[model samples]
Target: MPKMKTHKGAKGRVKVTARGKVVAYKTGKRHLNYKKSGKTIRLKGKKFVLFKGDARKFRVLLPYDWR
Candidate 1:
């Protein structure tokens, strides 16, 4: 069988944690942030785990990252 290729974009945007959860940075903070609330900006800086449904899809993209 041929080796499966990892989705480069997904690999860069999401990460597999030690416990096997998929974590990713929040979006919507790149531009026009000056108008956003301080709390919103702060919250966007943190990494959040993907929901079970989303994580399952990402797991397929990151075939080699079985962490």
Candidate 2:
């Protein structure tokens, strides 16, 4: 069978952790940072684990187990 192609867009945005969980960075840090507090900006820099339902969807896009 042919291998599935990894989604480039998802590859760049989300990542799989050592525990096989899908984590993605929070948005709203790209623009208008002047109005956002420093803590808010800092928090956005961190990656958050996706919900079970959402993670399952990401898994399909990131076949071959990216870690």
Candidate 3:
């Protein structure tokens, strides 16, 4: 069988923690920061856990991350 390729974009942005959960940075941090409220910007700094329902789908996209 051929080696499965990692979704390059997902690989770059998402991380699998030691416990095997998928985590990714919150969106909306790339532009127009000046107009955003301080709290909104702060929240964007944190990593978010992908929901189980959604993770099931994302898992397929990130086939290289073996459990």
TM-score per candidate, in order?
Answer: 0.94, 0.89, 0.85
Winning model by lDDT? 1
lDDT of 2 by residue, 1-67 (tens): 9889999998998888888988899999999999999999999999999899999898888897755
- Lowest summed lDDT across 10 adjacent residues in model 3 is found at 57-66
- Rank the models by TM-score, top first: 1, 2, 3
Model 2 quality (TM-score): 0.89
Reference-based lDDT, each prediction: 0.94, 0.90, 0.85
Clashes of each: 0, 0, 0
Q: List the residue pairs that clash in candidate 2.
A: none
Which 10-residue window of candidate 2 scores lowest in summed lDDT?
58-67
Query: Top model by TM-score, which number?
Result: 1
As for candidate 3, its clashing pairs are none
What stretches of model 2 exceed 4 Å from their correct place? none
Q: In candidate 3, what are the lDDT values of residues 1-67, reduced to their tens digit?
A: 9887778887888888878798999999999999999999999999999899877777887986747
Q: Report the C-alpha displacement of residue 35, candidate 3, in angstroms.
A: 1.3
